[model samples]
Target: MSELTVRSMTEIEFGQWYSSLVRAYADEQVAAGNWSAENALQMARQSNETLLPDGFATAGMLFLKGELHDGTAIGVLWIGLTHPRGIADCAFLYDIEVESAHRGAGYGRKLLAAGEDVVRRHGVSALELNVFGDNDRARRLYQSSGYRVITQQMRKTLTDER
Candidate 1:
């Protein structure tokens, strides 16, 4: 297993790395036809906005950076707090990606552990995420990391031209 250091993203440090995450996901999702390129960057813009933390922007939100044995960030996990569910807060996870070569090195697990530690300090009792049903690997990771399916939301595609 490679060594990892998880830390909060700085305002100046997030631009390039975070953009790569968004672009990579956008390219793949568009190529797979899961999303439309027809939105003219609006979808991406909105996602970027919501992904960044606002209320507890410093310690409450963070990125997981994994280093090679020699030190390089081959993985990143963007994490934040979701809207409170009951009296406890929920951790919202996104932008979690491990480089193709580094996926099995347990970096993702370390990131989740780090996220749990951070949120727990703030008195959170549970973590929640909305992952697409098609992402089996992610579903497994989240489940393995101790997340349970509280609910499933279904969406119907609108055929009428917008």
Candidate 2:
């Protein structure tokens, strides 16, 4: 694995990536009976637009270009913000998705650092994000970075209700 580069995503490129990534994830989730793709496309479009253009929001996308020795675009992280919610001034997250081969290379830490700076600059008093309970690796990263689990959101998928 070669060095990974993290950069601010241009509006066009990030829009492309955001849509593609969500659609891919949506397809998989629907097939797995985890979610309904009923509104996937609409949601993806809305998310892409809102996520990138929100003046109060920013996302740091990571990629390994030349380092993609295997001829693949490896992702390092995805840190961004969502609309604010109760008790939280705003929501921020260290959505670190390091390329499989680059895990443990400190990309998580770097991405968190960058995202925190973004959140602080926006005048958010508290940073908040949700993490999968089963994701021990991600939990460790957040915990080490001074983020704790404030709450857990749970839902049960209902299928065949028709």
Please tell me which predicted candidate would have the highest lDDT against the true structure. Answer: 1
Prediction 2 global C-alpha lDDT? 0.56
Q: Clash pairs of candidate 1?
A: none
lDDT of 1 by residue, 27-104 (tens): 666755667887625666666666554522545566656455576766666766555343246677766777787777
Window of ten residues with lowest summed lDDT in model 2 = 58-67
Candidate 2's C-alpha runs over 4 A off are 1-7, 24-33, 36-82, 86-88, 154-162
Candidate 1: where are CA atoms >4 Å away?
A: 25-34, 50-60, 68-70, 82-87, 155-162
Error of 2 at 95 (Å): 4.1
Q: What is the lDDT, from 0 to 100, of the residue 150 in candidate 1?
A: 85
Alpha-carbon TM-score of each model against the true structure: 0.72, 0.58
Please give the lDDT score at residue 56 for candidate 2. 20
**Residue-wise lDDT of candidate 2 within 58-159, one digit each (tens)?**
443232122244544455345444443445466555244555775687766655655566556657666676666656887898899998777876777778
Q: What's model 1's lDDT at 104?
A: 72
